[model samples]
Target: MASSRCTQKYAVGSPASSKASPLPSFHRFLTKVIQMNQLHTPKASRNQETGRLSFMAPVSPPRSGEAARGGLSRRNARRVKQSAPAFISSPCTFPTVLALKKIAFTVTSAALLSTFVVSPASAVDKDASANRPKPPAGMSRVGGELLGRTGTQVKLGVGAPVLPKDLTGRSWIVADAENGEVLAAHNPHWRLPPASTLKMLFADTVMPGLQPKTQTYTVQEKDLADLGEGSSLVGVKEHLSYTVHDLWLGVFLRSGNDAVHVLSSMYGGIPKTVADMQAHAEELQALDTKVVSPDGYDAPDQVSSAYDLTLFARSGLQKADFREYCSTAEADFPGAKKKNGKRETFKIQNTNRLLTGADGVDPYKGIAGVKNGYTTHAGNTFTGVAERNGKVLLVTVMNPSSKEPHAVYKEAADLLDWGFAASGKVTPVGELVPPRSASTGTGTGKGPAAAREEDKGKNGPSHNTEAVAAEGDGGGGGGVGIALGIAGGVLALLAGGVFLVNRRWPLPDLVRRLPRR
Candidate 1:
């Protein structure tokens, strides 16, 4: 038979004539071979004169030799059994080579596409790692390892109720106040603004030094000078003398920044009060807190975590005065002196809605007291201590996203309910670790014992009703730190792989083409 003619033209002496023309011929031959193999065309389909194959005709039964061999004829079987080198070099073998090339192209494209798809995820991971908050210097995780984790942490037993799904707080923790067993938590270590809740630490630290009934502070213009705009105040008048008891009432009942400032001044000054609060926090092992303002006013870097706030609540409640002040729903604040040389007083109610049950909010049963706080930056934060059936639970909720009035109190109430129900039914996720001095033998001169003694001297014997429990010294160690490092390393590797893939196949145009939200 005459060989088929090549009708296609290529430029003379061009690279296409030497290389490109053969590719098309090879491709066409492979395509036809593939069609023939798939269709299994009958022998009648081949033209006897040209010896050319056609695949559109009907298939035929295998010949006797092909049937014996299961598929191929004897001649074709011999060709298949030939050595690899000869088969590869033969023109009839181009189909196998083309098939392999197609597979290689497909695999390579798929791998490239996979890298492209994964690069954005890697970049996002790297960015998250870069932006993740670092723990305070030399500050260990006071709570257990589970508290260090980012999402919800819980260990339910056979009959424990699930945590409330409607909880929208950025960070929260429910724990036993007496035993310091953390029942459950969500983002417990996330450090955010604490608003006025930091006052628990402030009051815990400085309240011991000043005798509430014996000491009196005369409010000065400078005492209230640094008050933040729109600060809650208990109506402290300049040049009026207020007993330390009255100032604390203002702090707890009204969340009064003016009262906080005057007390801070009496505690030395705002700077000294802040420093003392920081030192007290470290002693309590509230490692996630950074106290910039004594009144928990929104200041730069003034942050605390749910875990730390719970620590504050637990520690503050151990003191008789702190407990009495926080639990007090309403109290009389000294007002301007009456004309008859008598000082009248105005009523100030506790800002903690769960305690006061004012403003249409139902009072949480068994509610004792801790504190609630709010600021534009901190949103709403609360830490409540409640007792039920001899089981006291401490719940701290921070930055709940709901805009409803008193949402923080509602969430705290819900968590408290869940905690009470789950008590003894769920295994503790972590422990509210003891103060630094409590673990170590060293005396910080500001330990719980010293605070207790100070409380005894100031508040007398009968007021010291609750005893501070001894906490175990178990440390969370370097587990969380190591996990963070590993995460960063994994993100780094992903970022590097993405960089290499982008170097080989640039994706700037493709990335730019992505539709904006």
Candidate 2:
């Protein structure tokens, strides 16, 4: 057998070319065998077959005068020669069995690594999905199973007025503000665009941190940026200063995106405001709501249910300021200051037709302020609370099918009328459950009536009847149990997968095993 000499070179930084340590004895021996086989093989044959060692082999430099025939330049060829490893000598014979064995080992190692490495990432994703609370299905049975049902749900006693025949809202709810009982509902848990009605939640979240009369912010150009095209505006002007009271008036009265943006900017920015609003919604147990824009502009995935909107109204009414702002039919908003330094003012009226009787809509008797919203997509959505005699009722209507203008207000008013007439004549379909913290004894979960009773005991009667009627028990849903159940199942599956993988591969380094009995 004639002996042949060959030299292998690797890229400067590749693992094969690394000078950190000499190759293991088995790898060195395999390298020598593969190089000898390559030296004897024809150039075309070598190109056609990709042996395991081909990646480690350097191209052979051309013989004398070959460089002049369109090969590497003299300087580059010299560098390649200098970088080449020491020459090896061996007989030319292909080690077919050994090469096949190495290739099989390489493929097996890759598969094992991928199984262990990628599985944990996939498991993490599954765990995250399992941990997030789902709406309607996974949410707490706040008002029992009746509120969670799909269609109309109500319990009418003998002679109780039938639900308004013309009610067409996709989702509607009627509940007693006194005892937290749901009087009637239709698709209460159906999530739909809430439009400006979501502003009620926004107000409940940001209002506490601000002092309407004391805290004032000068509007900046940046405050008005990204307000969504054709959004409702209260004509908020940049470079002008307005008290928080004026901004809120603009919000409740005009359903103004400009005022919303300015208020959100005062808190932090839109991102922070959105995050806070989301947190507040979760706390309120408004599980069906997903807040994408603080202003409630039509955006992807932003939705709320009639059940949740009613909860927002009930929570908001607990505060006196919220009651005052929502009920005010009209207010003067601050405008540009004149040259003489007196600030100009303009009148803005509430868009809630049931409150102001605007747009040919009749004002509901004893109607207190809540919120109303409309968008091309949302159509019309409203949540209102009203009092009759000494009893208070809350009603929410969303997305009526009728094309007539002011249909939402008409439907809500009808529902309110039915709720008052049905009082004491019908059993509640479900009761609004108090907030998780309240029911769990961690916070005050009392609705308006309970709070009023407490106040009467201490202060001897609440003379403010409007405040008393607007107030309602603050309650929300809880989904921790559902989330935990899903998480536990996922973890069980993960453990079983690990056990099977360990039985086959035996990762002693990662998972220690007990001794067999």
| The candidate that achieves the highest TM-score relative to the unseen native structure | 1
Off by over 4 Å in 1: 1-140, 440-517
lDDT, candidate 1, 392-451, per-residue tens: 778999876553566788889999999999888776667766565343212111223332
TM-scores, each model vs. reference: 0.60, 0.59
Name the weakest run of 10 consecutive residues (lDDT summed) in model 2.
Answer: 480-489
What lDDT score belongs to each candidate, Candidate 1 first?
0.61, 0.61
| Residue-wise C-alpha lDDT for candidate 2, range 238-291, written one tens digit per residue | 999988999999888888888999999989999999999998887766767899
